[model samples]
Target: MSTLPTGYRTVVVPPERIEELRTVDQLAFAVAPDPEADQLLPFPVPHDRLMAVESPDGTYAAVHGSYDLVMPVPGGQVACAGLTWVGVRPDERRRGLLRAMITTHLERSLERGEPVSALFAAEAPIYGRFGYGSAADQVRLTVPRGAALRPVAGSERLTVRLERVDPGRHAELVEDLYVRAGAGRPGWVPRATPALRAYTVGDPPGRRAGCEPLLLATVLDGQDVRGVALFARKASWGEDGADAVVKVREASALDPASTHRLWSFLLDLDLTTTVETPPLAVDDPLLHLLVDPRPTRRRLTDNLWVRLLDVPTALAARRYAGPADVVLEVTDVLLPANAGRWRLVVDADGAADLSRTDVDADVALDVRELGALYLGGRSAAAMGSAGLARGDRAALDRLTTAFASSLAPVCPFMF
Candidate 1:
């Protein structure tokens, strides 16, 4: 366990101390606090899961929290501690506060029976040293309005409804469709609590930043909700006239027809010249449906950074893609129990069995790379080429084939 400096201690952040936590967070992130916005956007962290470093003067020097998340994995889901809201006051840098806080987080998460932890990194370079790996990537697109899509047979038959978002009425609907739409895809994390669900649909005027109130677009087939999109438009006028932009906050569709119908409505919004999408999986259906993708501007980014708190449990939680018998020599710096040889044997049924072993390792990698390969989105051979992993050519090929996923893993929204 990491130790705090003299005169500093870690403390559990209670309800009354939330303001202090927020103050430290705002200072660290360089964002001004809006009380009204806070009232609308529910506090997402549970009190018991919130923690902070207290200075000698009783002020919070740093703060962090986690969400009890059921993170989807290949063929299953695992109890994941979604690490979030991490911040350290600028004046407190290099004091080992962040390291101490992370140690506490890992220990507490493991104590609570969460074998895995995931986060969307504020900065990409900070987490790998702590054993978190860049596990998945998401893509965003800025497409011209009226962009064409190849038609699906039933897309024209489904109808769309657009209205101002109502958290009371639409939160459940949005959550339901989100869960169903991402049924088999790895890294699809749903809003698991009432507060999280409320935050998803919440809109405060102060947070709108000149855009219209958030809106919901639903695609329905005979009163059955087939898809949903949460979006907002910012009006603009230029020499060309009425060149507005549509920004989609989150979108999910259960079927190809629903996806086609939803995008058809979003792309043709009156006065909007372009539409922006939220983060999407690399293999998202919308990408394949676009008739001409060349004209769209695309940005790819790292999505989820995964860490294994309990190596054996985490590896066993997800099913393998193919038959395999291999031993991995994994090194974990933060958690010493994970630093050893682990033999993983997968049968034809894709069920994996992992046990401690002293046999020769077929592959050697750090726990960070293991986390990267955990979701089946990354290739062991590719990491080997990058020198992040080591193995012979055949062993790397066997590991890659056993871990490949047909669909790219992505968590569409940041925690």
Candidate 2:
């Protein structure tokens, strides 16, 4: 490692160097306090796919990433990038290496046409300084075998395929599914690279192998991929036998019959006792369809942890549909100085007071929470009960829930 920032180099991880990248993530993120990145890179580092900011001078810190995204807009499309692994050695902190690394990567991402970037933050307060916020919610669930779903007598035309999509072609299908589903919700990523797609479909041995994700597709009439169910066939997620579940990977579809068939199909697996799904939209019809809400395990968690790589753009890109006059206390560990309070007020339909202000803040939260609430992790009502929000709990609850997504967060893959 070089003594100074000079002579530093950036390279995509090579096929052989992938293991080294994993070692760095294991070492650096291990001590700094976030495991999200660590969990994301549990497999081999896709060096050919991995982007890194390394110190040729032998500086000990480096950052790694897996894929890029394309953000869809009303008029056009922009690139949305995904940053998987990020870490800087303790000795390297305060030297601005993380920020510099993100800046270099994001700038290049933009150059590559990526308009947005997303990550699952290990620490809630680390990304705000860069402008990322809680853009989505994630969940963990458990179900019972007694409540196992059985198809209602006779249903046809739905086929479940456990086969794999070739690496060369899975990308198109995964991206297709994500984009179609994402348009209906907030805090969703639209791109699905090969690694991410396989991770979603392939469940290896161990807890994940037991997952047994069933790649489902519903066809009405000829051959329309109207709906899909990315759910594991396994009984549950935890070790305790108290739970039985079919972990939902990810789904994309619009047909009502398709949705009905998908859920009902998973509910009726043999030998399984229960089902626990991760953060589900409070408004999802699936919730209402359940005969007993008590049997369903529901908990709020941040879906997509946001870390603002670029402040102004990150804040501006998202469309806020909440009540006006809500300032926030944004916090970040990577950029501690950005850890302060700010106001978020709306004028007309767009946002105002995005810049720093001395006004009274309405909602005070960390970036991770923002990511949680952004997607569906922390409900305004839940936050109110927790005392994070002073606004009308019922109103925020109703509104956010209405916006709450029916889609589940399923990233079984981390390439």
Candidate 3:
């Protein structure tokens, strides 16, 4: 067994005893694959996994994460330990383990030079207790069989190239080009990894079990990689086998020219018969480029999870779209200091009210959900439906939609 780190509880433990720290989690939330599970088989990121909350009787109560995230914040580069798998053991319910983990995580995040810490919340009403708010929205899109796309006639001379290169090689190629495409996007992590690279060009479209993805990429210049799209083709149970759907894994272009050319190329594939791209940003240009929007179906989901480690800093950091006034009543079952009524007033002069207040606000919600909602992943009305928000239904809807813009939140890189 390995000895605990400084300031950590003394317990007979192996390095893999990390999961036991999540005992509180086993008691509180759904059981699933652990996020801290050894960084997806290939390239492991720099991280710190540890137990934070412990019972007076010496039982480990909860786990908290502290990563090297945001050490380079101004450079937009930072190692982060977005708190995850947080819960209390079943026998230890109603205690303050969640609070302890959150407080500790935030302190460590800042201490480690991480200006920000993020997480997708498991419950809508939970994280506000920690002073977080919804930050983004994600769109789930489906392209029908024979669904076609064409640029406004006589667009630039169109061309496309598709091939299966060595996974290790192609992924590196894609990552090398990814940074150029990620500008001006929110909640996006630079997704470049050997595992992802291998998955990019590994299994073929045959039936050996791993033929899962159908990757289509193109280099507009006919040399340097510019645009790439990953998808899986499967036949639906219908009279026509021609009816198939291609679920896109990720798509990006170095520039508008590449964007238009790449999507147009994929949508026009005669062999695919059909294509589907899951949740997209409302601001995504592909929707506008499409000949028609009615044919495309949008499914909403909660992605880009946010857990605010620092209230003042996180609130002041994000760029807002329109000028509006909203006072939100925040609720948090996890963190008590964040549980209170507050005014979130955004004005026409581009000023925002993140300060405390004694008056009622226009809307209400948990801090975490608000962070996700802030990004437009969950609409104010939708939050209301989930019982996380309430206020002027019409006004709230207008403000939330306008704030969301057309861009749908998406983080393809899991970590």
Top lDDT prediction, candidate number: 1
Instruction: Estimate, for each residue in 1-415, the C-alpha lDDT of model 3 and write its tens digit.
Output: 1223234352322355555654555556655544433243332322344545555666675555432332112112335455655666666556555665676666666676554577766776776556666565566666554455554443375467776445655666666565557655666665444544554444443321333445656646656566776555554445654554565666777776777777776666554565667456656767776666688787765555566544445554554566665666777554455567665656664445577777877776666666555444557777777766777787578657545534455554444
Stretches off by above 4 angstroms in model 2 are 1-16, 28-60, 72-78, 88-116, 128-131, 146-175, 203-222, 235-245, 307-415
Per-residue alpha-carbon lDDT of candidate 2 for residues 230-253, written as tens digits (9 for 90 to 100): 555555435644355556665555
Best by TM-score: 1
Superposition error at 35 for model 1 (Å): 0.3
Full candidate order by lDDT, most accurate first: 1, 3, 2
Mark the 10 consecutive residues where model 2 has the least summed lDDT. 406-415
Clash pairs for candidate 1:
none
Ranking of predictions according to TM-score: 1, 3, 2
Q: At residue 195, what lDDT does model 3 achieve?
A: 48
Residue 65 C-alpha lDDT in model 2: 73
Q: Is candidate 2 or candidate 3 better by lDDT?
A: 3
